[model samples]
Target: MIRSYEKTDLEEMVRIWYEASVIAHFFIPASFWASQKSTMKEKYLPLAENFIFEEEGQISGFISLVGEHVCALFIAPEMQGRGIGRALLEHAKTLKGKLSLKVYKENERAFHFYKKCGFVAASEEVDEYTGCVQILMEWEQVR
Candidate 1:
């Protein structure tokens, strides 16, 4: 049920973003979510492409990428731990090049999830707006 994103998916995407951001705040702040929307749309969305996972015709999760760099991946809280995230990461792997992304250092679940999906921690840096340390990860396929 993976497909390209459409404008109609915005509301659901926003909801998912909010939910994920709240979960992210154990290491940051909720207000960073509000502050980042314009930048996310103007900077991130244009550089990124999105894919939605549908079940029985409803979107249950999504992953967005900027070229080979994943900008976001989220599954509804109720829908998590059911392999949706892994499936999306596996789908990303089938794309034609190396893939990369950043995850909050304190979000251990996400850090481990990406690791399990074959990404390796390549770097770390502080996020300017949220002041949270983030780890940059990458996965590359040998030719």
Candidate 2:
């Protein structure tokens, strides 16, 4: 089931984010992800429109959106490949209809996954904070 993110979900959500980030963003240092955990919990997640995917009484995945921009999407490492990310993204789609996000150019799985989900890469730029090239992707519901 998809549900709104609540205060109680912070810890688990950060756990999922950190674990997935390490695996998917191997180009970045693991320490960088560790340093961002608290910020993700205290700052980013609280500031976004977050959705939690819970099943069998556990949160399997989640997505965070700030307006039409998707800020984050992650699934537990053990729980990946089961379409949870797509499910969470679809829930966001139903809410916003049109969505946008930036993906690290090196994260091929994510870039292709977003493409498979109908997002098209519109442009690319270097992220000042990470010194990594990012692709700006957008998806809109067909009218």
lDDT scores for all predictions?
A: 0.83, 0.96
- Candidate 2, poorest ten consecutive residues by summed lDDT: 125-134
**Model 2: residue 102 alpha-carbon error in angstroms:** 0.5
Cα deviation of 80, candidate 2, in Å:
0.6
The numbered model that scores best in lDDT is 2
Model 1 ranges with Cα > 4 A deviation: 38-43
Residues 64-107, candidate 1, lDDT per residue (tens digit)?
98788898998887788889888888888888479999998999
Where in model 2 is the C-alpha error above 4 Å? none
What's the TM for model 2? Answer: 0.98
Write down the TM-score of every candidate: 0.90, 0.98
Tens-digit per-residue lDDT, 1-143, candidate 2: 99999999999999999999999999989998999998999999999999999999899999999999999999999999999999998899999989999999999999999999999999999988788899999999999
